[model samples]
Target: MFMQNLPSEVLINEVSTRDGFQSEAVFVPTDKKIEMIDRLSLLGLNKIEVTSFVSPKAIPNLRDAEEVMNRITRNPKVTYVALVPNEKGAERALATKADEVNLVMSVSESHNLSNMRMTCAQSLAQFRRICGLMEGSDVRINASLATSFGCPFEGIIAPERVIDVIDQYLEIGIQSISIADTTGMASPRQVYELCSLVRRIYPSVDVTLHLHNTRGMGLTNALAGLSAGINQLDASLGGIGGCPYAPGATGNICTEDLVHMLESIGLNTNVDLMKLLEISRELPAMLEHETSGQVAKAGLRTETRPLSQNVIDLKNRNEKH
Candidate 1:
């Protein structure tokens, strides 16, 4: 029997444009990026983290945030989200009419400094300021806790610390929260426990899982989160992303593969695998290197396995003999 607690359908929030592109060494042209976002909007992703309004020096790949936002065809069905590092970023995102504003901080103090060059408290202050800037607007606010499971600077994080960050987000009137396995140090048990703990403490808040595949456990951790009654998940097309500041951190979970995995198990992510694969197939050319995703190489779940050529050759030899 299907687990009653498991959500039958989950929302896949594609963060390729923001999270994925931020790490790319090459700056994808503004027009191409906008075109990609437009196509993604129509392809049934529930939300798209479209771009980050960070300083050009910080993430030069996404420097054309305003042009990309202004040019993309907006689909009412898809929520367009932008990452904001501070109140100024929030203001820029609002001016471009982003549907939601996302802010991130690390639970690990050392990680926070390395990644954002700020203490956890200072990051919270920035989030608060962004909240104030976005107040009275229809734009929703979401808080992301990077290094939720483990930190490279520090080892395993206590669950209480994650809760502490959420408490502040809740107090600031941000109901949507994402717990990220930034370094992919999360085990399934830890993920399950964290999701359950957060659910128990703040049942009403929406939780999304943003996980990296640094240790090749992103999908497993996602499953754990789902088993614990969480739904939304963040993914990047072709699994392209990594923290520039955090050493050893790597690309995110592959979008097509994640959807393929969940859907094969009777869960719904509301994403079209074929359409998503079309996007994934282009990543190698787009980035000038092959991607980290496996589905593109392994084919879809519904496809029949390719027959063994050696077996066919052996049968032909026997027939000739």
Candidate 2:
């Protein structure tokens, strides 16, 4: 019955260029960012978070947000998204012609303070102001509820707190929301409960699950979300992203791995797995470090290799016996 209720198709929103690159200490060159994004455009991603429009001093790695957004080759089938923190960011995102502007706030007060350097109420007010600024624009708004599952500083957040945040988001007229496990501390049962509650109460809003592999529960939590009727998910190439403000937090769920799992389970992500693997392979050389993605390190499940000499000899001996 659980399998029967699962959606046939899922929408994968790639966040490598924005979320993945933002956490790097060394700046990823703007041209390389553009090249990678252009390459990703051809792949069948439902959306690509191209960049974040924030103060350069805050996140210097993504300082070239404007130029990257302006230069990327747009794919009509893909919705280009930009993360915006305030009115200024909304202006910049609008100028870059982003298809959607993602607004972020934490359901946990401590996380909101640590991440955004403000209280929860302040962030909500800021979001309202940004929404007002975007009132006349054609671009859409998506509220990202950080620490929806759990918070590094404050510990487990209550489901009622999360629902209240969603209530405020709806009140502010933001219909799309992303429920993020900022530190990846959620259990599978917790994920199902919260996601089920959200789906049951607010049946109209578009919800996207943003998970991390901090404690290696990312994929399991995602499966739980799917069981709760969630079809939109956020993943990063090579699994490269985490909250800079959250201590001990790790990267997001690998895009290639997620696509591979979904496809293996007879669900559709509509992503080009081979092409995604090619891109994932390039991350190590490009970033000058090892990435956390598993499928990229190991071959796909259906892949095969010829028998080794030792295995061949063992087989012959066994046959003779």
Candidate 3:
């Protein structure tokens, strides 16, 4: 059934430059990165994940994180968040005047060990230490639980395991939490059940969903999230950013595609679809790779002369179904 009663407004946090470029082989120049952010801002995005402040040895692509942070023409209305893995990374992010600092640790024990080289308990303790270090800083903390849905090394993650990790972040006084499908192992049922549970547990916390399209279920999972009362979503232009560990994994859901889907369904994202499409068009050339965005490849419906009989029939059949 169509969701006519769904809330009209939803927030889309653009993560193209940071999460999108983390896996890119070539380093996008600081100037180009700034240009991309600037353009994205013009498209009416309310938030943007600028870059991560991790060690240069870990993510060489963002070695110029400071440069990218310093160069962008930041919009006063838009919130720019930087991902900081540890206290040192948080310090680097704070120095850049980032509006928010996002901290994340994997929920699965094996994944946590592999990703952060720390146990779940140890990671929570580290986050508590980082929170203490903030000490009246303007930067807000948003703790993300990566692999909240499922893990590659360890198959299914228990719902209680996710809640246990979230409890730690909340106990440390983190107000915002971003639940990430780091390896894109989430399904619609999983998203609905888990998101509802999280919302129930943390009623006042600002929860955001960072979905991945690796299994072609990104949009479906997003709708499930929306039904579960999640309004904030993290998406990348051209569906960028794939897991380095997960073989055959795809990128995050495409920002333009998500926006298009939402708008088509009468949801307001405040994002200009045409301008977003322009950004997606330039992305492949900027990154020098073929993107998988259908809207980008086929163009928007408005660009066509008119709906052909076959297309109209397909739409009719879809509506009838």
Candidate 4:
């Protein structure tokens, strides 16, 4: 029998425009970014991380955050999200009227220092100030904990420390949490344990699982999260995204592949799988590089091809004999 705790429908958050594009060395033109986001909006994603409101020096590719955010046509059914690292980013995100601002930091001290140039405590303090800035506004705050499973510099993050960080985020009045496998070192058991703990301890908070395919366990870990009662997942189109600060890390789990698997397993994601595949197929041309997605290259499991002439001739000869 199937697990009773598994959710019937999972919520997919598309992050190509923010997390995916940030890792590219080549700057994706502002118009292209806006157009891609507009196309993604119609694919039935629950939320789309539109862009990051960061300094151009830090992430030059997303320097056009404001312009992209302003130009993209809003979908009433979709929540537009923006990555905000500090008060300045929060201000920029708010100015663009983003529905939600994702604040990120690392659970590992070494990773946090390398990625944000600040300790976890400093990141929390900055988040507090950002919270104060968003007070009374309609915008929502979501704290994303990077390197939650394992750190490249510091292997094996303790579960207690992750819970402690979540406690601090809750105290700061942030209701949503995103548990990220920054380097994709998370095992299925590790994902299940932490996600189950979070679910049991904090039943009221919203949780999103952001996984990477670096170690080839992204989809497995996602399944573990779902079995642990997590319904929200973050995926990138064409499976393109990784942390620049995390050495040897690869792209995220492919959005089309994940959606295809979910739907195949009798779980509902509400996303248009065909449209998603179409978008995934276009990524290679847009990025000028091949993508990591599988379903896009090898169509859906049900999609079949007709017999070739050679096969037909062989079959006819065998039947004639």
Q: What would the per-residue lDDT of candidate 2 be over residues 1-321, giving only the tens digit for each residue?
A: 555577899999999988999987668999999999999999899999999999999999999999999999999999999999888999999998999999999999998998899998999999999989888888999999999988887798889999999999999999999999888888998999999999999999999999998888998888999999899999999899865666545689999999999999999998999999999999988888888899999989999999999999999999999
Per-residue alpha-carbon lDDT of model 1 for 1-321, expressed as tens digits? Answer: 334477899899999998898988788999889989998998889899999999998889989999998889999999899998888899999999999988989999999998899998899888888888888899999889999999987999999999998998888788999999987899988999999999899999989999888888888888888989899999999888975666545589889889999998899877888999998899888878778889988888689976699998999999999
Model 3, residue 171: distance off in Å is 0.6
Candidate 1 deviant stretches above 4 angstroms: 1-4, 243-249, 305-321
Off by over 4 Å in 3: 1-5, 246-248, 306-321
Whichever of 1 and 4 has more lDDT, that candidate is: 4
Candidate 4 residues 1-321, lDDT tens each? 345578999999999888899988678999989888999999999999999999999899999999999999999999999999889999999899999999999999999999899999899999999999999999999999999999999998889989999999999999999999988889999999999999999999999999999988999899999999999999999889865655545688889999999998899999999998988898888888888899999999999999999999999999999
Candidate 4, position 92, lDDT: 95
**lDDT to native, each model:** 0.89, 0.92, 0.89, 0.92
RMSD of each: 2.6, 1.8, 5.0, 1.6
Models sorted by TM-score, best on top: 4, 2, 1, 3
Instruction: Name the weakest run of 10 consecutive residues (lDDT summed) in model 2.
Output: 242-251
State the TM-score for model 3.
Answer: 0.93
TM-scores across all candidates? 0.93, 0.95, 0.93, 0.96
lDDT of 1 at 15: 95
On residues 151-192, what C-alpha lDDT tens digit does candidate 3 reach at each position? 989987888999988887878898899999988899899998
